[model samples]
Target: MKSGPDDLAIHQKIQISRRTAGLLLGSCLVRPAKVLASADPLTNKIVVRSQLSAGDPGRLMNVFAKAYRGEPITLGVIGGSITVGAFATTKENSYAGRLLTWWRQQFPRCEVRMVNAGVGGTGSMYGALRAGKDLLSNTPDFVVIEFAVNDNWTDGEAFEGLVRQILAQPNLPAVLLLFMMWEKGGNDQEMQANVGAHYQLPMVSFRDALWPEMAAGRLNWSDYIVDTVHPTDAGHAAAARFITAMCNNARHADLAGRSGATSSLPSPLHSDAFEHIDWRDAAALDPHENQGWHLDFDDKGVAAWNAAAAAGRIAFDWSGTGLVAVFADPLLDPRRIRFRIDGASFQTLDTLKQPKRPILVLAQDLTPGRHIVELVDDDGGSGRAAGQQVRLIGIAGIGLKDDWRR
Candidate 1:
């Protein structure tokens, strides 16, 4: 695999914390391991394996046969916009659709049923609620859960809730957690896998698997994403390739025998920040490196306004970031709508800070690299502080660098 990102120091910290590191590494290196004790007919004692090397495509046909054994295999995909085929121009172009095509070719003699159960703007908490209808109702043989982009929308409670709901299913279907991305660099990979481990389920981390390829000038973010979170046609194809490879390697637990661009994550992942977030194990991320726009409320006191608070400020700085997206809401200031990113001057934009309404800000063509950003509120003459509750949603990081765009 290409050398890990330029941030070796950060992964070094992860390597030092052996326990967390081991799990993180396992999450990446030995992805989708068989649970051994599953009750699901398709998975029961079957274990999904990983490979460190890329091999022939023929092996994948065998992997599919082993997993299906000629019986009708039903696959259910659950997640946010990506799984729902958001930007895919045609149904046949979606990752799910492409996967179905592969399944049809691989198992022409056996029946394969595939279904899409993705909802836009929903997090894992909502995913859990819909599990009964989207996943369990169909009694799928395999279920793929995609929720990396939506994790930041809800608290950890909701994430775990989704995991528990799926693992608790009586059918005990073989479950694969697909941790997708919003921008090229936005997911908490280590934390995601830790949660997947809670249910002893296998995972497919598109971010960790794809990042190095993007970094080495072999892949690019735009090739995959149409907008911020949605994947374009090329992105779907790349995802399909990864799925095909994963199915090809499911039978080998050890990396000794495999082929075709094996995933590059080190075995046993860990990180200090992921620990603070309550994740059991996680793929390492650079703690010092900053991507996208990082904004946090520095003030201890939140302005409690019964109406739109006349202007608010959360001092923030950016460092040569590119193509970043911003989200804000009045969970903290609603009424007087519009906000600004203050540099030496304020760049005013509409920040629909309404109570419960999510405001999204897209700032493309950033000044090449690292820069600082400060959040500014504009109360515009209308003194409507309406239940003053201005809050900061979050930021998503997307990379437009030529190397990342492959």
Candidate 2:
């Protein structure tokens, strides 16, 4: 709600074009009348609802100051399906894409790169594990974090861990936490908001911006949400507007004499087990022994291992306490694999119920040292149905003691 003259000017300049308004109404699953009629009712309320967290103009001011100087920068977006543009007709209609467009318009002379690291159906748990390889590899200058809908109270530790990891980066990237809502009013915004307060980071809640209008009958759920979870193209536009307002507000913030804080690893609010995780595809492993295993190339251009028959196995040495096996979860019957660590008892992981890019933890928190791992085919002679097969895609490990080759 706090605003200055610059903020007002920025708001006045944000004009939603007729074509975008048409897209909002035309692409809606509901009737056009129901969406367009109520659109203006929530216009002013949107900006009022978007508030700066306890920490206004934190590191964001520094990023904007740099952009004002026309320096090239990279912005990274990391989250669940919403960040992945699930229900949006095209990538350009997604909130991330729209935000990039607005950024280009604001700083026409500066070069900006976009890095989207969203994975559908995954929460901050996997995001923290993959942040180093997937997102930070680009060395972004700013990062937008959105997992309020996907992360629950139980995952607060992982969520905070992700924040700490990003803040710990050498680049000292400006961080923004975004809270997206669900159709039935389900999300963990409060839990995430508490984490944001702990770190003094900026946060914007779409639920706060849109839900009140919906409850008061000024806006309907059909006006934005596509399904019960994902947002429609119009919904994405609204989200992009909220984020754009946030950035504009940041651009005009007063950070004249404040000294920026140094980037360092802070005391963790939750378990930071995934801070040093690394992933290696099956083809990347240097197997000391292999039997009955064949290299199968997938349509995605990934080389994976297929167990031709039972008892097929592969072995390797790793130096991590925690280990995770990544596999392709098919719709039909899937193959099973038995894993043994340091010659311990074998544990079988069934791929039948693991839908779409399933990852199972093989081991964790062992004494930090070199350990042997063996994987064996455990299909159990149950002949797969037609077009059913088990595939091993990759393995990821956390708390590695030594530098591992990719």
Q: For candidate 2, which ten residues in a row score worst on lDDT?
A: 13-22
Model 1: residues >4 Å from true position, as ranges? Answer: 1-68, 251-406
Q: Which lDDT tens digits does candidate 2 get at residues 1-406?
A: 2456744443332222222322332333245445544655545436446543525455777777778889997999999999999999999899999988888887999998899999888778678777887899998888989998887534475688688778878768888888888866778876676667666676777887788878878778887897787888888888887776666555544334544454455566555656666667777777767888877888988777777777888876766677766656542333456778999988765532333445666677888767778988766656354555667777767666445533
Per-residue lDDT, model 2, residue 316, is: 69
lDDT tens per residue, model 1, 4-118: 4533543443233333323333455433545522422212111122211122223233335445567777777888888898899898898888888887786787788887888
Count the clashes in each prediction.
Answer: 46, 0
For residue 59, what is the lDDT in candidate 2?
70
TM-score of each: 0.49, 0.79
Model 2 stretches with alpha carbons more than 4 Å out: 1-39, 52-56, 152-154, 255-259, 330-335, 350-357, 381-383, 401-406
Error of 2 at 215 (Å): 4.1
